[model samples]
Target: MRKHLAFAGFATALLMLAPPAVASADKPEPRVSGSMSGTLPKEFGPWAGEPVKFTIDAHGRPAGVKGTFKVFHDRIDGSKPVGDFEGKITCLAVAGEVAVATGVITKGYVNILDKPTEDVTGKKVSFTVHDNGRDDRIFWIWEFMGAPVNDCQGTAPAFKPARGDFTIRG
Candidate 1:
């Protein structure tokens, strides 16, 4: 029918004249990535002698990632296993070369603790990366401790790693 053809042509022309869909500027830019493996200083808590390792590659925000984050710990002297935990990266706020991330511990285990799964799992955790290259420092690792710990809602103290290298990008 001529009427149908005319309507199709008009719709096509209107669509062609419409403005293109632009990317949203409100969305967060790709940022925040860190990987490190070393021993936490004795100042943290009892698990100072253990070797800990973790990796965080958070790009966007809460809704983007499913697993959130992961942390690994191993016993080097063949004694007992170190503490390990994981959860989703709920929040990541970056400033300059330092980035602070927060999430909940869904599951974990620590040799020192009697019940790491029940103690650490379901609790909140935070990690700070001061990406200064070989001299880079870890601001805080709030998950390993028990109660009365710093949440790192804003900033946490920076402690130099005793060993291992760090590759943090912000």
Candidate 2:
């Protein structure tokens, strides 16, 4: 009779300590996608200016050119894109033709960068435009610029376009 009581107590304890069985199998992970778009202001400065309003298409192409400018992204610390900019008219004309255009993220803000990394073969000093858009090829570039560490930190940096150079292309 004592053995029966001990066995009953042991079974009760085991039942209480056992974990509940899972109801179903684990669900699959979710897939994420990135997007880009914006508008360019009628007047703006390439540097030393505020964020100009520009309509950046989903394909990452800039239209309405009033002046000569070139835009591209640069990888900072070999980790991710930290900065990008639209080059001056003279620079863009000399750099090369616009082969491909696409929107991308370096640190966080939407930016346009080169399509083929192999095409951007140059000294890593400043942003350079490798492809010209005259060819009419659709390109897409997207990257996640990490979030800020603190409130004191500023938002992601982006390239500024000079005023009187905004022109829309067909």
lDDT of 2 by residue, 24-135 (tens): 3353211111222232333322322223222222111133212222333333234333234332111111112222222222222323244322222121112122222222
Superposed Cα deviation of residue 40, candidate 2 (Å): 7.7
lDDT of 1 by residue, 139-168 (tens): 545545644334336455366765555443
Q: Evaluate model 1: give its TM-score.
A: 0.63
- The list of candidate 1 runs beyond 4 A from truth reads 1-30, 42-45, 61-67, 113-119, 141-144, 148-157, 162-170
What TM-score against the true fold does each predicted structure earn? 0.63, 0.16
Tally clashes: model 1.
Answer: 2
Residue 113's lDDT in candidate 1: 52
